[model samples]
Target: MLKIGSGAGFSGDRLEPAEVLLEHAELDYLVLECLAERTIALAQKEKFHEPEKGFDPHLEVRVRRLLPLLSNQKTRLITNMGAANPEAAATKIVEIAKELNISCKVAAVTGDDVFQVIETNHLLPNDNPQQVKKENLLSANVYLGAEALLPALETEADIIVTGRAADPSLFLAPQIHHFQWSMHDYEKLGKGTVVGHLLECGAQVSGGYFADPGKKEAADLADIGFPFAEIEEDEVVIKKVEGTGGVINLQTVKEQLLYEVHDPANYFTPDVTADFSKVEVKETGENQVQVTGGKGHERPDKLKVSIGYHAGFIGEGEISYAGANAEARAALAGSILEKRLSDKVPHLRIDYIGMSSLHRTSFGEHTPYEVRVRAAGHSDSEEVAALIGKETEALYTNGPAGGGGARKKITESIGVLSNYLSRDQVHPKLIIRSTDNETI
Candidate 1:
């Protein structure tokens, strides 16, 4: 049984669902994904709020809970939730395994965090000004692709974890570990990589984000299912845990096929080239897709990184009411707000949220009969609050757009922002690996 299991590195930072899978599936391979540029920014925000929080220190606790079960079953796990701190993540895992008397080897894939590495190595990307702006990055992570997994797979690891490797690599690493696949097996490797992508986002392929018109009876979304893979030499079967609820159908598979994936022909990752168009997904049973016919291409020399930048401070606030001509009045009211704020504090960058009349007022199809117009901004000066207050009152009267009553500001705080920076190249060293099968 080429059994595979999935763990979503979703925002809650909880692994309760994944732990449940380990107890039930007796999984041979576990894939976890936790890297998104947005995730990094969120981690940064958490760190900024509590400087000592450092990173996702809580994921380890969840993993520790599963260690005992994994110890009995000997199920190997791989995850990319080690955001911005793989070493720290591994250290915590090691500590847990040692205490539980469960022998496990932990491996980490580094070289993804290039924010500081670039400065030390003087490795920067193209000379484009915008690309160069990445030098000022608050965070830099190369969606490093698959190269990060090679070292860990080569070691004795029962549970391997990583951070910021591509979403699919979480799936590909297991293939590399089990088959000992070579980097150059473009065709077979590519097929394996494609299998990983299909299952990486558990719910996406299981009808959470997409639905099948032909298979209405196939859905059980209330308890949405998670994806799993049955691996073979050249193909994989996509299914979910037995008791879980959800549907995996053609439309759902098709939607996940193109989600954020640009250039299906050249879908790049460190592992193998995955050709989506060449892939065929057939509903083999309820909650199942027999995936095959995938082809891969040559891997790229340089890794692609996900970088983020501090655009500027942005906030939103508004007031709503039920009355006739509400949309128009809301628009006018928003304009009045900006005018008032600008008159009082001209230098402050002012914008009315719902008042797109300052721009294009396309309210889509069902325009709200009773809506709201809000204003917000970012200024390097102390006049920010004053501008907000001034605009709040302007909706009552005077200015280009006018409405009624008092306005509101959505209370929020924006601080040090981040961007991405890529290095031209680097000499990555060996980290450890997970030890499910060890040689003395």
Candidate 2:
């Protein structure tokens, strides 16, 4: 059985170390999906401070621990930890392996960073002049597909390191390399894609978000489990890693089926088309959910892409006030500021939202009043200066509430980022392992 597992954790310290989490759970292959817009920006910030830091600082630590586990030949890994510099990241892993005297090859797959190349080739549309910027381009990641990842896995490297590949590729690459699934094997590829989607979120498919129908209670989710996929040509099975603390029931499988799926019939990826609606999940045992009836279609020629850049100075400020009209006063304060700033900078857009008693029920119903106001905008530093100029007056307003402060323009930048089709007709190259440890 080819057991595929996904790892979960935020960019920072919010998540425990992978070694700590995977200590009990056993798996054949481990995949990490680590790309989000916020994460990319955070990675870029680290890159800015130390030019060597291209990927998340946390990933390097995780990989250092993951390598020794893989020396047993039972555990291999594919991770997007490569972030911006897959080659450099791979070199680091190889060094770690050498230190342990372990024989393992690190394959770095790249060619997905399309930020500079996109601009130089004029791949961005001219009509969207607002998006084309030279300075504010924060992070540029390409939505790579499985085709580019196959060669790296073919080398049978200990770990496949990559930048921002499509979320499904983490699951799909293993099937492509193991079964030698052809580029056009839509039937088998679709089954593999479904397996990938099933296990992509780690713990989600293991009942973190599922509701039980038999009992009027949630799954015993604490120490919640991560997903595992067992694949074959005629069928596939979904389960959780052994000794983990979650259930895999019919309800949980259904919930995972609906997560982020755009279309049921045409669930498309670069690998294969997954017919989600036709899928049937049956509880065959205590923790195993039998998966069958997955159908397929042809893959797309062009890969879908995701891009982001610096979008000026967008910031948020929050302050609490106590009074009966606290909510109203906060609203009025934001309104007054919006009108004043709009008059000052015609093109400025102000967004204010209340994040307090307005949405929560535990604010002691009626005895008190407090509002948390957050405002954000994208404009020049001069515009931010104009907005901050009026904060004192808003603070002193004789409005309904009393004793509140304003926070304005916490983050500022003038770069507008966007994405588009790369019309330059460049072939995305996939290199297995470079001896020089240099970027291609």
Candidate 3:
């Protein structure tokens, strides 16, 4: 059996859980699925400003902390923390290894950045052509598959860093590399993809996102553990480190299995069109769940591309009201800001935090002891966006008797859209660098 563990789920996930996995799990591979839709776009922006700093902001911290633990161990690391610049990320890792005197090989898988291939006149998936201007485009990255990672793995690199690789493909690559599974074996590929999907989100399947206080209580969630999978040709079992906080029973497994899956019968990925419709999960032992029956067909002809563009600026302001008639005061404050800024910021939104913020519809007549009034809007002009928070903060002395704790913020928003490119157009290349060698 091959054991693989997840070091992180998202860009800013806790680092301690990954440390636990490295210290105890004795994993054969550790995959960190960091990189999200807007994350790469933000990284691209950073790269535009500073060429050498487009990778994950926490790359140095993670590599500095985890590299030593992986030095003598057989465990290899794979991660998409490379974001907009995998080559730079690989170089940084090599530098960190040299600083710590640890000998290791690092491979960077590139060619996901397909900005040059995209045309300004190209149409988006469901939208019209050329809706986004070329000047406003931030980044365009193709989602690469398991095949792209194969060469990197074959290089015997201790660490493989990639840009915009499909989430499941990261886990499936290791399976294919170790087991020598045929690329055409759809059934096994689907099963391996299932394992990847389950363990990709780190602690989600092990009870981090599955927790509900009274309805579904997980043990010692404050110190939740990341998940790992033990896989063979015919079997897959999900488990976590012993004595670790969290549960990994059938319930958690079931929830995670369908986490972002839109269609059970046809989940489109860069690697394969996985079929999780017949997949089953059974709790065979404590903190262990056996998964089976996942299948797949041929992969898609066109790979999905995530395109990021400048989406203007967003400004928001919030003020709290407590005690009697708090809801009424908060509502009044929201109305005042709406009327004040509606002319300048046409697309304004006012919400009462304890009341109609989430659903946008009123709940009932029941009043809460505290309510927060928030005014937010998006505008092409930074000055217009700034007015939203400025007007809302004026409520402190302007009215609404108990108003307090006023806060405001303005941020440049990055909008993400989708497009498709022919799979043949994306050619992933591997560049291997080691602490022992100067050239890649």
Candidate 4:
């Protein structure tokens, strides 16, 4: 049986559960899907400040803990934690291994960055729902497929660090390495792709995000165990480390299966076009669910690129009102703030918490004792954006009764721009480094 587990769902996921998986699951490979569309963009911003600090902040911590287990040779690690600087991350991992007195190999995969291509080709945005400007682009990364991972695996590296890659490709690439599966074998590739999707979110398949009070509730969710997939040539069973919190049943598996999956019949990736239309999920045992019937087709010719650019500054403020007529006071405060900052800030959003904030609630139907009024605006001028929050805070003493806990913040916004590129356009680069803190 081939076993793989997810260590992270995002950049800031808890580290202990992943540590538990590394110590117990006896995994064949562990994938850390730490990069998101916005994550790499922010990393690029960091790169501007310092020459070698764009990788995941937790990279050193994770490597230090995993180095001991990695020396055992049965398990290897792969991650997209090297978000903006794979080579730098590789160097750091090797240095940590040296400090731990363990010998291992680290491979950094590169060439996913399409920043120069965006400038040279003047490529237009692809499927951009927001119609973001291509001219303001900061980071442009092509989502590399599983095939780009083949060379690094061939190097027999204990750890592989990548930049921006299709989430499933991180797990599928290792499967391709272990099974020695041909890229043309779409059926098994599709099955492997399903395995990747199920485990990528780390805790999502283990009931971390699932809870409906009485209708659905998982066990001991506080200590949610990271998820692992026990895969065979044809069958895949999802499970987690023993004696941990969270449940792994049909409900959890069903939710994770459809996550971020827009089309059930055609899910495109660089390696294969997976069809989850006929996939089946059934409980095989306690905290275990079996997956089957995933199909695939020819790979897509073009790969999707995620581009991030400056979207101006965002300033926000919030004030809470309590006691008598709190809901009414909160509404009045929002209206007043809007009127004050109306012309200064062209785009503003105001919402009353515990009232009709998220959606339309019955007006005065369920009077609440407390409500928070939040106002935010976006603009190119820092001063203009900051005025919205200042005016919101001014509502504390200027108008309304019982308005307290006023807080304000301003942040530079980095927005995402989606685009496509020809498969032939982006190329993959590989760099192998040894455990002695030396690059090869």
Candidate 5:
């Protein structure tokens, strides 16, 4: 059986859970599935300012903590933490290894960044021309699949870092590499994808996101454990480290199996069009669930690409009100900002926290002890955006009564659009770096 564990789910997931898995899991591979849809776009913004610093902000901390544990074990690490720049991420990892005086090989899988090849007129998935002009485009990355990572695995690298790889593909790549599963074997590929999807979110399947107090009630959630999969030809069991806080059962497995899966029968991925409708999940033991019966058809001819572009600036300000009629006072404050910045800010949004912000409708009238008023505006010009926040903040003495905790800020907004590119257009390659040799 081949054992694989999930080290992280997203860019800012807790580090302690990963440390627990690396210390005790004794697995063959550990995959960290970072990189959300807009994360690369934000990383691209960072790269625009500093060439060498586009990767995950926590990459160094994660590598520094996990590398030593890997040195003494056979477990190889795989991660897409190289958000916008895998080459630089790998280089930084090599430097960290040298600082700790450890010997290891690191491979960076590139070719996901297709900004240069993309055209401004390319139609997006929504059938509209590119939303952002070519000059305003920040980043365009193709979602590479498990096959794109094959060469990096073959290099016998201790760690493989990539940019914009499909989430489940990171786990599926090692399965194909170790089992020597043929690319055409859609059945095994489908089963492997099921395993990848389950464990990709780290502790989600183990109870981090499953807790609902009385309804769900997962125990000791403060120290929840990440999940690992034990896969054989005929069986795949999901398990976690013993004595760790969390529960893995039929309920958790069922929830994660369908997480973000729009269509169970035709889940289109670059590697394969997986079919999970007939998949079976059974609780065989404590913290162990057996999964099977996943199938797949031919892979998609085109790959999904995420394009990032500058979406202008957003300025926001907030203030809190207390005592009787707090909601009325907050509402009046919002109205004041709206009228003041109506002409200057093109798109303005006002919200009353603890009131009508989330659902956009009030839940009957009840006097709240306190409420927060937030005013946000988006504009092409930063000066106009700043005006909304400034006017809202001015309400301290000019408009609202009993207002406190006033805060204001401005930020650049990035817009993302989905598009498709032919698989042939994306060519993934690996760059190897090791303590023994420089980058090659």
Candidate 6:
């Protein structure tokens, strides 16, 4: 059995749970997924100023902490921690390996950047041939598939870093090289992709974020354990560290299976088209569930590209009101802020945060002892954005009684626009710059 573990569900996940796996779990490969829909855009924004600052902020910490545990284990590390720059990340990993006096080869996979095509001809060649504009475009990256990572696996590299790879592709790549699974075998590849998808979110399927008060109870949630997939003869058993917190059941697994799925029958990827409509899942043991019945078709001809741009700014302010008629005071404060700053901004919004904030359409009933009135705006001008927060802060001194905890700020945001291009458009390759510089 080739055991693979999920070290992280997202970019800012808990570090301790992964550390526990590095210390105790017996595994072949440990995959860490830390990218999201707009995470790459945010990374691109950072890279705009400082060239080597776009990768995950926690890359060094994750690698440095896991080095000691790698001394006696066979688990090799795989992660898309290389957010915007894989070469820079690989350099940092080489430095860390030298610092710890550990000998390991690190490989970086690149060529996800589509700006190469846009910059030369100012237009794409396949499908979307519209003139590519360099005006507000921050980052243009093609979603590389599992096959793009095959060259790295064939090498003796201990650590593999990638940029802009599909979420499930990160987990499926290792299985292909280790199990000798054919890239054209859609059935096995599809089931493998399903296992990758189920385990991709780490604790999402292991009950970290699936617990309810009285309906579903998960024990030791405060110290929830990271999950792992045990694969043997084309079957997968999802389990977590023994004696750790969190529960894994049929419901938890089922919820995660359909978490981000738009359509099960036509789920498209560069590797294969997976169909999860009839995937059979059942609990086989404690914290262990068997999954099968995932079907697949031919690979897609095009790959999705995420194009990021600078989207204006958002300014927000929040203040609390407590005691008698708190809800009325909150309502009154919202009205006052709107009356003052209504015509000043483009997209001004007012809400009683504690009441009708979550579901904007639903006006909540039964007010409590306190409610927070929040006013916000989105604008291309920072001055206009800042006005929304400034007016709301005025309520602390000029409006409502017993209003406290006034807070205001402006946040820079990134906007993402995705489009599809042919698979031939993207050119992925492995850059072997392993740490051969031994300076202990």
Candidate number with greatest TM-score: 3
All models: lDDT? 0.64, 0.65, 0.90, 0.88, 0.89, 0.83
Candidate 5's TM-score: 0.95
Collision count of model 5: 0
User: In candidate 1, what are the lDDT values of residues 1-440, reduced to their tens digit?
Assistant: 56777766353533556766777776787776655565675565555576533345556666778778777778777777667766656766776777777778877666676666655654454443544344344565667555567677666677667767777877776786678777787887788777777777767777666645565544556666577788888667787778776677777787787887999877877666677778887888877788888788887666665555544433334555446666666656556666556654444433434444356555655455556555666543434654565556544555433354555553333223233343355434446633343222
TM-score of each: 0.79, 0.80, 0.97, 0.96, 0.95, 0.94
- The candidate, 5 or 6, that scores higher on lDDT is 5
Query: Tens-digit lDDT track for model 4 on 356-382?
Result: 887856555788789989998999899
lDDT of 3 by residue, 157-206 (tens): 99999989999999999999999988888878888899999988889999
lDDT for residue 273 in candidate 6, whole number 0-100: 94
RMSD of each: 5.2, 4.8, 1.4, 1.8, 1.9, 2.9
> Model 6 TM-score?
0.94
Instruction: Kindly list the per-residue Cα lDDT of model 2 for residues 49-127, writing each as its tens digit.
Output: 8776787567767766666766664577888887877766777777776777777677888877776666676555455
What are the runs in model 3 whose C-alpha is more than 4 Å off? 120-130
Quality of model 1 by C-alpha lDDT: 0.64
Candidate 6 error regions (>4 Å): 118-134, 361-364, 437-440
Task: Give the winner by lDDT.
Answer: 3
Residue 435 Cα positional deviation in candidate 4, in Å, after optimal superposition = 2.0
Error at 375, model 4, angstroms:
0.5
| Model 1 lDDT-worst window of ten | 410-419
